[model samples]
Target chain A: AQSVSQHNHHVILSEAASLELGCNYSYGGTVNLFWYVQYPGQHLQLLLKYFSGDPLVKGIKGFEAEFIKSKFSFNLRKPSVQWSDTAEYFCAVNEGAAGNKLTFGGGTRVLVKP
Target chain B: SAVISQKPSRDICQRGTSLTIQCQVDSQVTMMFWYRQQPGQSLTLIATANQGSEATYESGFVIDKFPISRPNLTFSTLTVSNMSPEDSSIYLCSVPGQGRGYTFGSGTRLTVV
Candidate 1:
């Protein structure tokens, strides 16, 4: 079975501050990585995904993640964050290309202060 | 992206009762899934509803507890039967959107008391 681990349970940042959220997954074979964000009272939306090719994947809203195969990590990063970025973020992994059953991590609650 | 409409956004039900949540997609999709999100936890997949066949449940889930129906390509329903306080969680349905990304519905908040 595939499992995801998010090191940070909660994160707080001031406006204009840089942000990074660590995500690691345990799966032996080919895997697809994804990042999702859910704002207050909104549905979960996909931030970005990494299926193949370049490990550095860019997502919406000035967010990006680098998939380091050796590290088994796909950490989300943003040079500058805004108050509007306050939301709950999730890291998910699909074990193989056969199915879409995603295993998600314990989410990270991001609170951006003005 | 396929748009999904879910009914009874939130409901309060007494123990031993049942709640059936419906999900209707705007367009046809090949795969539709149901998930549960407990308070302060991540999304846990309940089952995979296959059209014209029985649903495939995960390890901890069973058909009698979470009976699902996928009558067609774009619609599915999940029923939380004989609800208990432990069943108090947000239920959501999802499908593959553009670029094989996931598109989730606004979850149904089920409160079993």
Candidate 2:
């Protein structure tokens, strides 16, 4: 069995502020990491993913994440956030051989103040 | 990526009733996944539907409660039988895309009264 842990349940920040959301997973096998964002009244959308190669992955909307294998972490970060970035973010892990099934973290609700 | 169209979008039903949500994909896929998102919670996989075969349910889910129909490679349906307030949530369908990504539907919001 695999599980994901998101360090923050909720985050609040002003516009132009830097943002970082911590995500960690527990799986002792080859894994694929992903970040998803769900805006208000919208469905979940893929932000970015890390399957192989360089640990640093960049996503749509100026978002990015770094996969640190030693720490078992895939934390999402943005140098500057806008009010439009307010949404609930989820971190998910797919076991390399688990038939594409994804295990998601609790989620972090980000509120960007204008 | 494949596009998924899911409906009704939303519905309100009385207790003990049932609601069947449908998903139609633009392309054929080997497996379609159904997920449940409870209030303020993350998504949980309910089952995996494959054409010409029975669905494989997750640990906490049962066939009787969450019946899935995968008649073909491009379409699937999930039925929440004998619904209760606990069954009220967002139901989504997903299919694996190119480059190992997954594309999701808009979701169905079911409310049991």
Candidate 3:
């Protein structure tokens, strides 16, 4: 069985402040990492994913994440955040290559204050 | 983009009753998945809905409890039979993305009282 852990349960930041949310997964085999964001009253949307290739992947809204295999982490970062970024973010992992099952982290609720 | 639409955005149901949530996709997809999200929790996969075949349920989930239907590529349904207070959660359907990502429905908020 595989599991994901998010270090932060809640994060508070001011507008224009840099942001970083930690995500780590426990799986011995090859894994696929993903970050999904759910805004208030909205469905979950993909922020970015790391399937293969570049360790650093860029996503929408100037957000990016780096996959550090040694650390077993794929932390999401943004140079600057806006008040609109207030949402709940989740880290997910696919246990293996073939199956589509995704094990998700507990989630981090970020509040960006203006 | 693969668009997915789900019905009955939110509902309040009595315990021991059943609620069927519907999902419709704009394009044909090989796989449709059903997921359950408890309040303020991560998404947990309930089962895989494959067209023309029985659903593949994950560990701790059974067919009779969470019966699913996938009549075609673009349509699927999940029925929560004999619901209980513990069954109160959000039910969502997802389709495989072109890049192997997933496009999820808005989710059905099920509250069993």
User: Against the true structure, whose TM-score is highest?
Assistant: 2
- Per-prediction DockQ, in order? 0.65, 0.67, 0.64
Please give the interface root mean square deviation for model 1, in Å. 1.7
How much does candidate 3 score in TM-score? Answer: 0.94
Off by over 4 Å in 3: A96-99
Report clash pairs, candidate 3: none
Q: After superposition, how far is residue B80 of candidate 2 from its true place, in Å?
A: 0.2
Candidate 2 DockQ category?
medium
**Per-residue lDDT of B71 in model 2:** 88
lDDT of 3 at B8: 88
The alpha-carbon root-mean-square deviation between model 3 and the true structure, to one decimal in Å, is 1.5
TM-score for each of the candidates: 0.96, 0.98, 0.94
User: Could you tell me the lDDT of residue B35 within candidate 1?
Assistant: 95
Residue lDDT tens for model 2, A56-91: 999999999999999999999999999999999999
Alpha carbon lDDT of each predicted model: 0.92, 0.96, 0.92
Q: Which ranges of candidate 2 are over 4 A from the true structure?
A: none
Q: What share of the true interface contacts does each candidate keep?
A: 0.57, 0.60, 0.60
Best candidate (score: lDDT)? 2
DockQ of 3: 0.64
lDDT of 2 by residue, B4-107 (tens): 99999999999999999999999999999999999999999999999999999999999999999998999999999999999999999999888899999999
lDDT of 3 by residue, B1-113 (tens): 69999998999999999999999999998889899999988899999988888899999999899999999999999999999999999999988787768789999999999
